[model samples]
Target: MPAAPTAAWSLAEWLAWQEQLHPKSIELGLERVRSVALRLGLLPARAVTLTIAGTNGKGSSSTLAASIYREAGYRTGLYTSPHLQRYNERVAIDGVQASDADLCHAFLAIEQARGATPLTYFEFGTLAALWLFREADVRVQVLEVGLGGRLDAVNIVDADAALITNIGLDHTDWLGDDRESIGREKAGVLRQGCPAVLVERHPPESVLAVAEDLQVPLLRLGRDYDFSPRDAAWRWQGPSGALDELPLPALPGAMQLQNASGVLALVETLRGKLPVTPAAIAAALRSLQLPGRLQRVGACLLDVGHNAEAAEVLAEHLRSLRPAGRVLLVLGMLADKPVEAFARLLQPLVSRAFLGGLPGARGLDAPVLQARLRSLGMETEACRDIPEALRRALAQAAPEDLVVVTGSFVTVAAALDVLHE
Candidate 1:
């Protein structure tokens, strides 16, 4: 729901337009966007799309797939949601963003195409990403679900290969209250007679049930594809074949190895159609980069682990490092999430807190965060925003101390911006 004059606005101004269009920030279900998409002729791209859905690993899977395909010399497009800093990061081709002019053109195109239908912020953005990908004629497009997969705007395209990374109780309010219910919601993107990869180490039965009922060729981890680490290297085995020797992924987390493994399984699943060479696979594995996943700056660590599930992986990585001094956490989170679980996971790992406000409407107030810290018996400092929080951490931290920014993407994003500067 862009402004009436979106055609006259810049990308930022148009984004502002979209913000006002939807009364609610996030509307879960795909009916409205799907109908608009059908009217706009977007369903055919469904035949060529590989939609990846999950709470934590959707971004990682989409990027990994896009990189592998592009390194193999295929023109590839990658789309992920809730960009950290810039809006353009949500859409890319061959690792570069869709230009501002192109995005503006897309905004105009979607505005024209929507007619009387109202689209959510994510829905409009999804349509724009699809529009850009179709116009550019990329060989393959890797699309990440904005929310639960089944009725998301991205589901309008029937996925050629749908990868459900894992099910978690995220967005429980909209999808359902448990893993089984959430898993069923995520299972919505699977298309019949196509390859569907289940990357979960332990998948819920709901996901498996949907796959069986849909009649898609299911490739399950440990069953259809498997991999392991040995002597600073790893091995992969898939339905098409095996890679006995491979470089460990450069993505900077233990979780990413399994993610890359799934991508290889998918490539193998579509071998003849996609045709990725060993060298390309190796190159993509070596060069793939994600900024905020366990990144380090001098005396500071930053990650975008916003949920308890993600925090577990972050916690393991932190434990391995065993920083000399206690961790000082700079925290912020969205109001809707389970703040208690996120805080609980990091409490033992954290020694104190520098509570701060994140940069959006959904962010938790610094005072509320400070209260949480006090309840845990942790020392607390307050700051206006991320830069001030980091400045405080830098001054207060011993050279041996580790400052971790957690709680949400908004928190990590602010820390990442300062670290880069």
Candidate 2:
């Protein structure tokens, strides 16, 4: 077995070491993680737990729920994956990321407990987050599934409530080929008798079947709960109650209302354990801010949306904005994503496409993306990296025009680093 990480190691060093400990980056199964979690006493989480799983809106939904709980005077612990900026962003307490010392301590504990068992990077992070939450004695915990729900490391914790925000064709290689098959995998987060909130307007039959088989009380958007635009605001009505004149979520995009509505539903389901007032709900909506989800830095908008479904939503938002000059796109994506479909959906809205090569083994090259966009009759330029692509796009963009940086988290992170610099 590889030598155990030293207690003196920094958070960065521990993370780097953990990455190399596992042979495969992603091995979707709960046995190994569950064993380690059991040893750490993380099962049957002491806090009221909410687990969110979906293709597009998991980050937004989980953040909204955690914000609401925080507003309600609860000590909230939130854990999300693939952070845009730092690894610490993956674990938070009351909207504050865990400190380096805190994360390192948790890692040490897990290392000692695991002995010789190997754990994936995500598995290690999940265990660390749970350990920190437990140690902090948090009142509520919001966990976002990293990938598919069933086998995802976060699933080890049976949440008090589960929220599945719309399913789409993403990670098809691991999840499934079609929406139906993927829906089933996402629905695995739901436990029997536990209430589940589904934001999908037209949910697949497989999802419904899982809820039925599990005897889960499913609250679906448009049917069991929904929201509508008021004159200047919006209104959300769910099984528990309705909140009117609700300020729109601070997060951009019309689809956020759907995510917020589902978060409210999840909040309502856990009302018995962690009661939240309508005031807290409204306050949370107005205050929540997630980076890289249609985030605007100066005239450039950065969104970490890579799937075709997300691209479609992005197209609508761009149309609604209707910049006087033109929309320029700086995009980079992983090789496994549906690059052609994503480009095709956004082609009409985009005036010019600047394709940037992403880093790492899974990253697609800029030349490849340029070729795909050119074949679709879209004007394109290829750049060596996202920062280069952003710089070129910004130079070409007029004062009234908007430059959008999107495709993947890594893509947006690169743009953000340069923009902030």
Candidate 3:
């Protein structure tokens, strides 16, 4: 049962209360949220909304989209999930997190409107973000779907344009087990006749089928729009036109170029309505930042690549780096993840591995992870916590060697906390 508040509750209080509101952390269907949204009159919005859904790259895509819109002089509202540190990080207006007071106010409004209805923590936050966006009078809103697009809370509002960055096997317990099923679930964000960008060069048939069924003008990678690397920079060509000599993405890795291409395709799709300048696009590309996806902090390289597809992308980045010394991996993952497959993908690159305990009910403890890795014929060291694992990795690391903290967002968040401390 949800806790009752007396007098005034702080943002933290509201968040804590919200956690206990629902029995399950994630209930994917949207009826409860849709009803609440209807009651609050949040449907049929003002802003030109861009909803992004993917197994990976959703954060990068959303960040790039918001920054591009901001550089174009539009007031942008960006809502992303699983904040690394602060809850404020989830809701950003013009690149600034919403203030505590503002979040509290939004929560209060939602509480008043919801009545007897219950909402998950994510659902509550989604509603609050939408409310905040509306109140801020944002010209454009970029929403990252928390889970599968079809029934995700963020899917309540129909998008003016949408992007499904890539369909990979993830959240299989909730979404189906195959790429085709996952692709169809993500393609739910596509609105009829809306310009939808499919970033995957080889997208699942179900995704394409959805786009075709809904009459969506789908711009696909290696099909409708494409990018090519030129040393440090890249070039993109799409239906609207071509952009040459574009700067390499501020975010590192080969995967980001693909993400940037999708973002550009989306920008081109909404060009008639938004009309961003080339200069703004260039500036945004060079300046955009998302915290956890392959962020380099001092000597440590942190990534939140937990699943097989993300692990493969991380492998690509590692192989590209080809460090002189060695790549020491400090890893922590949730219990439900495909640990064996994830560990096996990077086995060739990782010289040694440090497994750490993760918190929460779904956490896979260090011993289990260490056993899993060792069983795969990799050298493994088990540690009590993220800090301990990182400390061990750093102690053993040579100056030329790299220490990668990865596996899950929780893992990266913990590593970051220790790094900051």
Clash statistics: count for each candidate = 1, 0, 0
Q: Write the per-residue lDDT of candidate 3 for residues 63-140, one digit (tens) a residue.
A: 999999999999999999889889999999999999999998889888889989989999999999999999999999
Which residue runs does candidate 2 get wrong by more than 4 Å? Answer: 1-3
Ranking by TM-score: 2, 3, 1
Between candidates 1 and 3, the TM-score winner: 3
Model 3 misplaced regions, further than 4 Å: none
True-structure lDDT of candidate 1: 0.83
Worst 10 residues of 2 by lDDT: 1-10
Q: Which lDDT values do the candidates have, in the order given? A: 0.83, 0.92, 0.92
Candidate 3 Cα lDDT to native: 0.92
The sequence of per-residue lDDT tens digits that candidate 1 reaches over residues 1-421 is: 4327555578888888788888987887778887777776777873257889988878888898999898988888899988988899999988899888889898888888778888888988998898888788888999999889887888888777888886776788888988999999899988888988888978989988988898989899999899999877899998777897788888788888888888888777788688889989888888877767787777887888777788888888889888888799888777778777777777788888888877666777787767765666767777888789887988889989999887777887788888889
TM-score of 3: 0.98
Minimum summed lDDT over a 10-residue window in model 3 is located at 1-10
Tens digit of per-residue lDDT, candidate 2, span 29-60: 99999999999998889998899999999999
Colliding residue pairs in candidate 3:
none
Please give the distance, in angstroms, between residue 232's alpha carbon in candidate 3 and its true position after superposition.
Answer: 2.7
